[model samples]
Target: MPAPPIDARSQNARVLGVELCGDDGALLRIMPLEPVGLLRAGRFFMLRRVDGTGPYIPRPFSVYRQYDDGSIEFLIKVMGPGTRSLAQSSTGTELVCVGPLGNGFPELEAGTPKVMVAGGIGSAPFYLLIQQALAGRHGASLAPEDLTLIYGGRKAGFLYDLEAFMDLGVRVLAATDDGSAGFHGNVLDCLHKQWEVGNLPQTVHLLTCGPEPMMEAVAHEAAAKNLECWVSLETYMGCGVGICNGCSLATRPDGPLGAWPVAKACVDGPVFSTSAIEF
Candidate 1:
């Protein structure tokens, strides 16, 4: 069997800062007292609220960005009770964090042209990813022009962190269904247009994270072109570790015994190849 992404650990992390961003999203920064060497781009942590109680399972959040001082950040949208509590948390609050769990994105070949497609908060992991790419940390020695981002949301305001990518010298194409952004449609439409006009690189690889329907649509497009694609799945979890089996995902066969297999998202992956799993 493949090696687990990273060993799990529980640490008390202090809230460093919280800033409201696009829409109802909050960017939270936390600093762990203990060093978590496993924390990095595309990985995640399960945060147990300090005042958490019954029915409140620990919440899993992707590592939005990791700082040199070992601080980690999360870009969360307040959609429910758990997130609301998190958003209300103030500086100095202690959260029990368990992770750098799950597999990260696979390394791409150096100099390979790449395109990242994200929907709303799905853009979380890519911030650190872009940072790594800029520093040549992921075997990807890409220049600013070699990387492009196609991001989509319901409206322009939903496309948070556009400037973050822009500052990294990445080309960003924004799409909003309401026509309140760069493209007056979904990201798939923008990608299709880029394909039609040969605006995309000839040997491009795709990295995407988003709502299931959107990711599935992007996967289909990649399949049609026989291009390589990687997808990060978003799912609910009872425990941030694999023991709960709360985040199982159906995957394509790795062996001839069967066509489908079940894998734990928390430990096996929050990231997987676009063709390897069923959404």
Candidate 2:
């Protein structure tokens, strides 16, 4: 079994700030007591208020951003008590933070066009990924034209941090269910449209993170198209480490993780190739 990174340890982090974003989300920033070195885009942290104001079990959040000052940000949708507590946090508030956990997205391949499909809050991890790809931080830097983001939501407001992503100078398209945003459909539909119009190549690498059903649909599409695809599962985790058996998912018998009947989302991955796991 794989283990959490050696640098993974629980520590108290001080709240630096919280900014309301999107329709019902907050960009919560905190400074860990100890330095957490460079973090990969999709890696996450387990967080909870130190004052015991929220659930005893800390909630997991993807690392939205990591600044030079050693502070990290989590783009949290104010959906439940766990997130609400974090949103209500004030400067100087202390919270327990665990990790820099799990494997992030794989390195970018040169000459392969990449398309990212994000749903609502699932857009969290892509920010850094796009930034890194453009900056050549990931192996084989990509041009802005080589990267595309198809961000979707029920409405415009769910497409969190839209302008920020656009500022990166990559192709960013919006999709909304109610026709209130860019395209009058979901992300998958938007993606198909791009291909149909020749805005994107038929053969391209795909990466997605969002609601389970959305991810399932994208996975099915990838399988049918025989395209290489990866998914960042938004699984419910009791513990962001391997100690708890709560985040297990069924594995594909012929896939890379087939040796194991099941894989733990926490340590094994929050990111896995679509071929390695069943939807």
Q: How high a TM-score does candidate 1 get?
A: 0.93
TM-score of each: 0.93, 0.98
* lDDT (Cα, tens digit) per residue for candidate 2, span 46-132: 999999998899999999888999999999999899999999999999999999899989899888799999999999999999988
Question: How far does residue 211 in candidate 1 sit from its true spot (Å)?
Answer: 0.5
Model 1 alpha-carbon miss at residue 64, Å: 0.9
Q: Which residue runs of candidate 1 sit more than 4 Å off their true CA positions?
A: 1-6, 53-55, 254-260
In model 1, the Cα lDDT at residue 224 comes to: 85
On residues 1-279, what C-alpha lDDT tens digit does candidate 1 reach at each position?
Answer: 434454667778999988888888898999987877745578888876776631257788899888888898899977788777777788988788878788888775766678899999999988878777767787666787778889899998888777886788888899999999898999999988887899886668899988889989888888888888988888888876767778888887862224648877777678878677777
lDDT of 2 at 23: 91
lDDT for each of the candidates?
Answer: 0.81, 0.93
The Cα RMSD in angstroms, rounded to one decimal, for candidate 2 relative to the true structure is 0.8
Superposed model 2: Cα runs more than 4 Å off: none
Candidate 1 global CA lDDT score:
0.81
Global lDDT of model 2: 0.93
